[model samples]
Target: MNVRGVIAGLLFLPITILLSIAVCLARPFSRLAWPSKVMQLWANSVFWMSGIKLQVVGEEHLTAGKPAIYMANHASMIDIPILVAVLPGHVRFLFKHTLMYVPFLGQAMMLLGMIPINRTNRTKSVESLRKAGERIRSGIDVIIFPEGTRTKTGEMLPFKNGGFLMAIQEGFDIVPVTIHNSREVCGRNSIVTRKGVCRVTIHPRYETTGFTVADRRQIMSDVERIIGSAVQLRGRDNAAPVIELGHH
Candidate 1:
């Protein structure tokens, strides 16, 4: 077992509890602002504890005080904190409903008013995205993992249509974010995490102003390609990456 990974994993539970409490306390001060600010701290803490370095490109594309749909290719649980750490504005996630049972994490999600998508049910999932779209129009940035679940391999998964449909319905610009090397740091079903750098490439926003439902497939294909552009083609690994990657 990787010693750093084992130790880091052990600390996660306490770290989560402390951060979750902070989120709950911050909620009373300013609904979204305080909570979001605390989450940024939480994300950074996760990075620190895991010894994971972050490199962000196209951060200029993330406008402050703007509401848009941020679509990203998901690979690992680390991707959650990665999005929270890098993306600007008050951002919330379109997450699985099952996360609602993850102890302190679940309560914090509820406090943040994060949208939970019921993946087992098609209509309910659409309804969840609809609710997320409403949140966007009301001036909140939402991050959606179009892949729906973490990929076991380093390859991109087929993009799901729910988030794209919501983007068209809401008429928000889609920021296609590409996350690199997270799977190596923390793979699916793994409890330990290794030290590594996870580079995030935030491409220029894809506007959905004139796009209709019919255009979603093309849009999904395009966004998926953009995100996959920077991903390294290789078999998946569960430990920290050994080879050097990403420019500083």
Candidate 2:
């Protein structure tokens, strides 16, 4: 890991936490509106400070006032911020169970109603998915990195079935999100940074209306194929409008 990268990350941690707190406190009254704007502010700041540029495409596929499961490929630390900043609606995150215990950040996450699932334990994982499915039924959009962890190489990893299983069981639509070049910019295993362009392609959504638990593997494979093809098509397309993040 780069010493400068570590120091830079540490310097930004407090500001990020403060932003999280502010969003949490304002969430009750503003609901998704204020919180979503604040989140974009923080995300944009992180990317700008890191000297990364964002190009997000296919946002028109996202239907306003509708809930869908956004299953994105995980490759770098910046992927979360890119998605949070670019996605049109208010989206909740599915975090690891252990993250729920992290200091003030954890409390703020709870206030935001982020879902945490224990992947190592079957019973707990199922229960967590059930809760998440209920939230989807209630019209809350949730973002899940189906890969479960980041890929060392930029290539997509085999996705875990948990998120697909939940989407199928709840009959929610699955949005296949492909993130291109983020791993090259800031890899998950290393904090070392590079100034480069990263793109997020939101592919057409897959409906799970008639899917069952038995179709989990198939559903996962279909989404993977869609994202993989899209990722391969990434380029410096000046035609696609870049999502601009305002200074915090």
Best-fitting candidate, measured by lDDT? 1
Across 70-158, the per-residue lDDT of candidate 2 in tens digits comes to: 98888887787888887877777888778678776577667667788889999998988888887777667889988777887678888
Runs off by more than 4 Å, candidate 2 = 1-8, 27-31, 101-108, 190-192, 234-238
TM-score of each: 0.88, 0.87
Question: Relative to the true structure, how large is the alpha-carbon lDDT of every model?
Answer: 0.79, 0.78
Ten contiguous residues with the weakest lDDT in model 1 = 239-248
Model 1 CA deviation exceeding 4 Å by range: 1-4, 233-248
- The digit string of per-residue lDDT tens for model 1 on 104-153 reads 77777777678899988988997898889888887789999988888877
Residue 126 displacement in candidate 2 (angstroms): 1.5
RMSD per prediction, one decimal?
4.6, 2.9
Q: In model 2, what is the error at residue 11, expressed in angstroms?
A: 3.4
Residue-pair clashes per prediction, in order, are 0, 0
- Per-residue error for 64 in candidate 2, Å, reads 1.2
